[model samples]
Target chain A: MKGFKYLRNVTTLKMDSGKCINCSKCIEVCPHHVFALNGDKVTIINLDSCMECGACAKNCPAAALHVDSGVGCAAGLITEWLRDHRLLAKVECC
Target chain B: MPRISADLTFADRLGSWRVRWGIGRMNYIVPPGLYAVGRPNSDSPVLVTANYKKSYDSVRSVLAERDCWILVLETYGINVWCAAGKGTFGTEELIRRIGASELTKVVSHRQLVLPVLGAAGVAAHKVKKETGFNIRYAAIRAKDIPQYLDSGMRTAPAMREITFTTWERVVLIPMEFVEALKPTAIAAALLFFITAMLQDRNAGFLAVCGYVGAVAAGAAGTPLLLPWLPGRSFAFKGVLTGSIWSIIFYMLAGGSGWSRFMALAAFMILPAVSAFYALNFTGCTPFTSRSGVKKEMKVALPAMACALLAGIAIAITGMAI
Candidate 1:
């Protein structure tokens, strides 16, 4: 994390602190340590560290977190686009 | 229950090496089912993992001198993290696997220890509700498994954090190298003949080597020097490496002999190639997010395409004269 940092202000991750049940479920699931408990609610500690893998959002019982999760590979995105456009005969992520 | 050997055999080692270089990589999978690693009783720990041989191998090899039940989930040969993201390693699969394997009968405890990376696909509460198995995310990497088990299954902070060390980057280089091999070869072949006909044999060979170097810089160099490389965007990092490659190429190829326009062409085209390779590496890295990569591609891809086309157009126009 010290060396590997991706584009800042690009992640779609959003946190609704008011809706947080203080379960700390997001904190436990987030691999990037993107969330922290500020008082009785969950807060985004480091938004840049959020890879938007969607573990927190999926695991959150209160539905307080949101992020459009998907594979973040250029090649994978291109393949997705091609598949959407019907350009590729077979769409493969790898 | 099938008993698995924690110690890897020569064939297993060879298979791993082959897959690391992208040989039979897609099909490199173990059968999806429950297996006993070491003599295990009902009270032994149950660790869940993907059916990908690499994932399975990493987990088991670290578990030597320990007794456990490994519950292998079918992930179509993809690694746990990737499979989880794609939903092949999701709740449905986990629940189904548990039922199919008769997990309840085999193990007295209703706990399933899973790798933390696989958390993306699995919902812990849901799994617990559906199958009555308490999901325990033990560690991010297999190397940390021993510590987790020995220390009363406690997940230390370091066990959860992902580290992309130099050796980790080095190992991934081969796959990137192999992935870029075909395209690089074709482009180099075409560049060699075109440059030879347009400029001279000497310049053609130099151009080909330069192009190859750009690919290496993007695929290998950028990753190795990732932290040291400037810029957050993978494309930007690649461009820096490619620019360096271009400069080094000019010096090595004797820029004095090549025409000024041809030199310009190499500078434009080679770096773009490097950027492309570097951009492709987002798939290999752990920290890169889908949203961030999408934003980067919107700008980087068009710029690279334009650079490539302009460099080719300039070379042709200059060569005609």
Candidate 2:
């Protein structure tokens, strides 16, 4: 997190500002520090740092945060795609 | 809460080592229930954690001198972070564990200090509303627990933060290597047998070495030199390493006698194989996201397949000539 950064603008993380109650649960839970309290509402400050771990979204009481959270690794995604397309022998995601 | 010893014996250390090495890791679990960290009573603060032995050990070892209650949820030996993502360490499990343990009758406080990383599954408000135990995410690391409790249960920014230091990255490598062992062996054996039939025994041996080198460069080397590698996409960095390995092999293995086509094939195939393995290593990492991995595979996987196929074709043609 300090010295390394992943790809930019690829995360599907979104925040519903209107639904935010500024409880700061998202801020407290996020390991990446993706959220910030902007007055009475929470905002995605470090949007690119989001790893889509779903911590913030899951803990959000107001349901203001959303992200397509899963095993964000190439092997898992490849296995899923291949299975869906029937391209390879059924292999489980590790 | 039942009083239990917090001391980690030699056997626990050996067991943890075995688990880290992927031996009996899946079944290496502790019974999920409320246990004492030190001499804890009903007044002691409660800490929630997964039932993975490693996770339980990590929590208890940090609270050696302190008295606390640890609520371990049944996560089927998975660590807190992954188990949280899988929902085994979710709201339902927490609530069920609290109820099953009769935690309300044991503890006077309504708060349950959960690991910050576990927030992905447990909804604090829902847990509070349903079970009357207000979930408080204490800190990202268990080592910071004492300070967190001393600071009146308030988590400082640094405590909540996550950092993937070099040492942290290095520690995760062993499991990755262990997981990849079977696949690597099978691939190497296949390469050896196929190349022996296609060429000579010495050629088969050389081909096997080349393939193993590629795997090491991608699965092992790439992670060690991750920060310094030149590309955001792991596949690209792996390709660079693979190309370097191929060139080194060419010099060491005497590729000068081969046709230009054969040398080209070696460089292409080695790098592509390395790149594919490196890309797969994304699953072992902390930062790579679903969308990013998908985008990378879309471009890299096809390129790897094409390079591998073309390299084989060129190698065959050069041999015929």
Candidate 3:
């Protein structure tokens, strides 16, 4: 996660300090280390580093983190689109 | 409880190799329950992992001679990280597994050691609240599990960091290659026959081989040289890789005999082919995000389609000439 940088400004990661319980769950769960404790609440220190894995949001107790998390997989997207169009009979994804 | 050895048998190695190439990958599972690694007693540390045989095997192999209680959860054969992302390895399941396995009876301590990647699904606080078990998000890799346990269950910074080294990339290549092989063969056979019937058999054979090389460029080359490849977008990197392959193919198969149209077609078709496969690799990567891949596909997909179409159109023209 240190050197592998992806496209910039694409991730939908947002943090609400007002809603944050200062639980540090975001810091703990984030593999990319995107969140950091600023005083009490966590801040998105490296927004560009976010993979939007949603680990932080999923683990957050106070509902303070937000990100559109899903598999960043082209095959998964194609499968979903096919299913939406009813072209695929069964949906399989990772 | 099944007392499983920490050491893997020759059969385990063979199974691992088979799965790496996408054989029996879906059903590669161990039973979802409790197992003892190295004869773990009740007081030994409890480590949780998905029931995916690969995941289970990784943990056990790393443990070697170490004593630990392995709680294999039913993730339907998915590895820890992906299963965690899908919520199959979520807090609910962990709590359920603990209760059902009568884990407290098996382990005197209430501590559950989980792979750091599993943090995506399991909430430490929720598990503690429900099951009264303290969840320690341990090492991301099984290799680091021993050190983590040795360090009194505290995760070191290195243990938490995610790295996509060349070896890591190498191990993932087999499945991706195999996934593309069948479809590619079918498409290539059709194209090869058509081209042979239409113009020259030599051209057909060369073109099919070149196309397969392009696929290899995307699926195998891009990932192996990923860190050094140009562009952050995988599709772009793949195009570059394909371009390299196209050059190599052209030089090897004697491009002197090729018409200008054929030469042009190689660049266009090969790069486009590579770009599509490279784009598909987003799912296999450690750092790529859902949004980033979506954005990349939005821009790259149309371009690849156009390049492929144009290349085919001109190839037909070149062949007719």
Please give the RMSD to the true structure for each candidate, in Å. Answer: 1.4, 1.7, 1.4
What lDDT does candidate 1 reach at residue A5? 91
Error of 3 at B314 (Å): 1.0
Compared with the true structure, model 3 gives a TM-score of 0.97
| Cα lDDT computed for each candidate against the true fold | 0.89, 0.87, 0.89
Write one digit per residue (lDDT tens) for candidate 1, span B102-221. Answer: 999998989999888898899888999999998888889999999999999898988888889999989999999888889889998998998898778977888788889999999999
- Angstrom error of the Cα, residue B183, model 2: value is 2.2
- Compose the digit string of candidate 3's lDDT tens values, residues B35-123: 98877787899999999999999999988878888999999999999998899988999999999999978888889988889988888
Q: Per-candidate TM vs. native?
A: 0.97, 0.96, 0.97
Query: How well is each residue in A35-88 modelled by candidate 1, as lDDT tens digits?
Result: 878877677889999998888887777888899999788888998999889998
CAPRI class assigned to model 3 = medium
The alpha-carbon lDDT assigned to residue A29 of candidate 2 equals 91
Question: Which residue pairs collide in model 3, if any?
Answer: none
Candidate 2 docking: what grade?
Answer: medium
